[model samples]
Target: MLELLAPAGSMEAVAAAVQNGADAVYLGYGDFNARRNAKNFSREEFAAAVSYCHVRGAKVYLTLNTLLTDRELPQAAEFAAEASSLGADAVLVQDLGVLRMVRQVAPDLPVHASTQMTIHNLDGVKMAADLGMTRAVLSRELSRDQIEYICQRSPIEIEVFAHGALCMCYSGQCFLSSVIGGRSGNRGLCAQPCRLKYGWEGKADSYPLSLKDLSLAGYLRQLRKMGVTCVKLEGRMKRPEYVAVVTGIFSRAIHEDREPTAEEINQLQAAFSRQGFTQGYYLDQQGPHMFGVREETKEPKELFALARSTYQSGEAQRVPVTFYAMLRPGEPAQVGVKDPEGRVSTAEGAVPEPARTRPLTTEAVENQLARTGGTPYRAERMRVLVEDGLSMPLSALNALRREALDGLTRQREALPSRHMGSYHVGARYENRKEPPVLTLSVRSAQQITDQLLELGPALVYVPLEELAAHPEKAKAPAGTAIGAILPRIAWDREFPQMLDNLRKVRDLGVTDVLVGNLGMVAAAKELGFTLRGDFGLEVYNAQAVKEYKKLGFSSLTLSFELKFPQIRDLSKALDVELITYGRLPLMIMENCIIKNRTGSCNCQNTNTLTDRKGARFPVVNAPGCRNELLNSQTLFLADKAADYQRLGLWAQRLMFTVEDPQTCVQVTRRYLDQEKWSPKEYTRGLYYRDVE
Candidate 1:
């Protein structure tokens, strides 16, 4: 059966889901989940929610899907143990550290890869399978055909977002919120700054970044036919009424073989939608129609009342029970109740009396024992063995039936989960005597002049477009490795030409290629080029690093989101590197900022955006690259070279973005030596502080 997974931000939402026919519901128990801002349940509430869903024949999937630091990893592992003990149907997770801990603590618990993992393609999904994930909630940006491709090649089950609000940036890859407003999406508190107004090159893209809420309800059959095992709704942070309506709609569309009516589609939008709806990256369209911002749309008061009516009065889910009753002229009346699982309990009533005005019939025994309408249980079958002229008071029969049903409920609640104790932490990192190698990344040919090359770095990465357009810029002095940095956003219409551009860069003596996204990895492999993994790949954990290594990454750049301690511990597992200096690219945006705001784009690589705080951030425009939003302040980490080596990590990169040729040389020289230097305006970034 095709699974319709709903979101449950609170206990009320859980009831809303099951009452409306969700096969399973995903929610959070603490701040551990990505939707930490939502009204999540407590540990006690989580257990109750799980039990409540299980009793109703539905499953509860807990979301512990945020990236965790080293300090919080043990706590996350303990929670995993608790989830297993509570019999969670599965856990949706993003961090590879959590994946490792779950395998150790609760080996039997199925792990579903959260979309925060940014698994958009086959290789990304294959990596999930390699790490023991049983299912993957794929990236929302994937087209239907891309989803079909991943599903076909997937070793595990595929879960796709069929509906709800869409994120402007790719999941797990957005650091714009963190750098700009100190709210990291990877840590689960997104400020949602993308919803703000911004313009691009002359096009003036209104709400260019904010996408419309996704609605694929009309395409459920086509998706199921494509072998998509689970269709997930996107909002756990939304209201219970929203969950009830969306879940009920998709559930029927998937299970009842019913197509959504046009009226129902309108109800979906009226209930909660952003400028109507878009099918999203599904349907293979990334045109102007996909963009939308919030609009004024008041929901009908009647619709909310009707939706709440479904779960308020009675048990949200019904369970069937069979009953057996006995009565005799002088013996006590008794009733036995058994659930479908064969758990049985019997309750004794007051002693039967001799017939007075009326004789006791079999119908008399059955009538009192069969009334279970208010409870979770429904009487499916009833058998009564009775002697004529036996009688019992109505109160006695009612009490006996209630007692038996209560006992049966207790039996179901007592069912044990597959429990594994806490997982053990593995090996630790040791300090290295020698300092790690240094690499330099420059955006323009102007920054990689003779003075910078004199520093004699281990490797130098120039933008691929720069290398392809001017081969002279890629030429390095003897013993200094030269490579081309792949563009982060490689879109469809131009991807074929992008590959050709990569090949052109390769032919010009740039053998070492810094590939970021999965498509770049695939392209590098196809062209037989040496692939260097960039930080854009989101390699946040040891497992992800190993997976990329297995995919033939010669060198790996760890995710910038990791704290210093996490970077240290992860480096112990693999010889990884971190960027030590430069203006970190905060966003790789599809829409051109200059074109939107200025009413014209000079197509020049230089542009600046002033935020509400009046801080100016640089915008880099280049061939083959998306609009690059650089951080307002540069990242200065040269003072931490010793600290980097102390973690047993081997490399520190000096990135030169928006810096002039002279500043690049000066920065390179300062870092090459043990010279302490910090730019006038620089940030330590996420290195020292915890993301949350």
Candidate 2:
């Protein structure tokens, strides 16, 4: 049977999932994790939770899935070592430095690639296998057939998201959150602007980008039969009641081949819903609606009553169950604990027992909560209660506990008990290294040629916008961008300015020009210019990279969001040199803030946005535009240099910034320099390959 993995934002959620029949639960504990907003487990909480899950025969996977910076290396590595020592089954990772740390400190622990790594094909799967990845969580954008194709060719297990919220952008490849909200999704501070209502700047619809949730309940059987190892549910942001219901539904389907009854499935909608559900990109083709259309749902009175009863008992656990019930005055209730064996022994009376904190009956709880209306389920305390107005029978309360216990027992038994180590820990052989080549980004033909005389990089990169910035430089036509002038320059005499610049760049020592626009490609070919792919183009998959190569570019930069396996696949499949080092550009936006037409943005300049963990950062919109300047994602891979070189990498690029040039250079040296450098603990940004 396939494993049913669930998300847990806290120890309460972990317990709830384990109790409700989740085979395994994935959560974050510290800096390297993806969900910065979730109530991540503290070291003690994490260790205790792991022990609790293990005792109940459930598995715990730590999330170390965020992008990392040089400064965060030590903390990330320490967390990895701590997680391993605590007996975590695996750590879900998204950065290369962190991957290396696991390979050293806890060489025996398994590493699962986080979806932020954006992997999608058989070649990518093979590359991950070569790097010791045990599993690859295929990208959400893949169709079922595409995933199946990869599964057939892959050496490691394949895991896919079976349900939950879907990102409009490619997984881990989006900068919208960070660019617009100041919270980088790559670093787990996602401001879900996608859910916000918006009027299109030029489109027909009022809410152009709002998408629906993905629900493949109708297709669970098909996924299981495809040999997919795990069916993941994606909602750490939801309440435990939501967690319990979803977990219960999927757990039954995957384990018994028993899908929810129509009414039960409708219960999901009643609990909460958005536009509705779609199979998402799993069907291979879709529009923005593949995300789902938003819809409102009302809670059923019966379900609400059930939830009220569960909450009043004070015996509630948070991980796997959500109580949804309405309460009235004078309800009878019992307080008790349910053991792993499915037995519930109600404690004597319904009072707050000092030792066990046994919960009160409905009558007492209602009286206490009367002023508050009712108590919503609190994960931290594992309690829920109806207001002073609710009531229910004692026998009915016992029955509810029994039902909950049964679900928990079954969920706990589904996960594996043994340790699953780092991605490449059990590899049969080691890889050989090859030094990387270099690429230079120049502002003009003069700078290009001058630098080339003494330092000839393998490729030359330039920005389209920059050409227009310096019109008098005699490099390109006035106002025509690099993309537009590339074809018109050299051969077109009317474009004397561009011709001079192109000729000078070639004379200087440049071997190739990186271009993204088709006009530039056409211009380069017409002018007989040497060309290499530029980072401006978002090259995500091997197919895309190959297409660019066929278009005549000699090399390509893979999307910064790609996982190690995806990187390895592109490296092995294409003959062109690939660049792998540098501080990754986590955000690229068409909407410019500094140059915005709007005098000011709608966002409050002094408003502080709080992440899941309640850590707050002050908000600041870029001057003169609706575009916002959010947090930036940092990239570092010094610890995994040998691993990357072995994958046929040619060179790495470091972005030169006014503030971070020295630091970027130091980090680049740490990875590219050949003199016997000792490996220091580091966090792997998006290149993490552990996908199990």
Cα lDDT tens digits for candidate 2, 1-692: 87889889877677567656788899888856778788888899988888777645568888888766434556776788778877788888665446665676777788887676565556445545654668878777677877776677668899998778876554665665654445667778888765654332322233334456677777777887777888898988766667767777777777678666787678666655676677756774454444445565565667645533432344323232223223333334443433444433332223222222433354443333222111112212234544432344444554545544444444443333443343222222222255666544432333433313223344335543334344333233232222222321111222345545665655543335665333245545666765655543445444344446556666655545555665665423334344344323333221332222233444433433333333322233321121222233334455656666656555564433222333433444554553334323223554663221
| CA error at residue 612 for candidate 1, angstroms | 2.4
* Predicted structure with the largest TM-score when compared to the true one: 1
Provide TM-scores for the models. 0.81, 0.52
RMSD of 1: 5.0
lDDT of 2: 0.54
Candidate 2's C-alpha runs over 4 A off are 198-205, 291-692
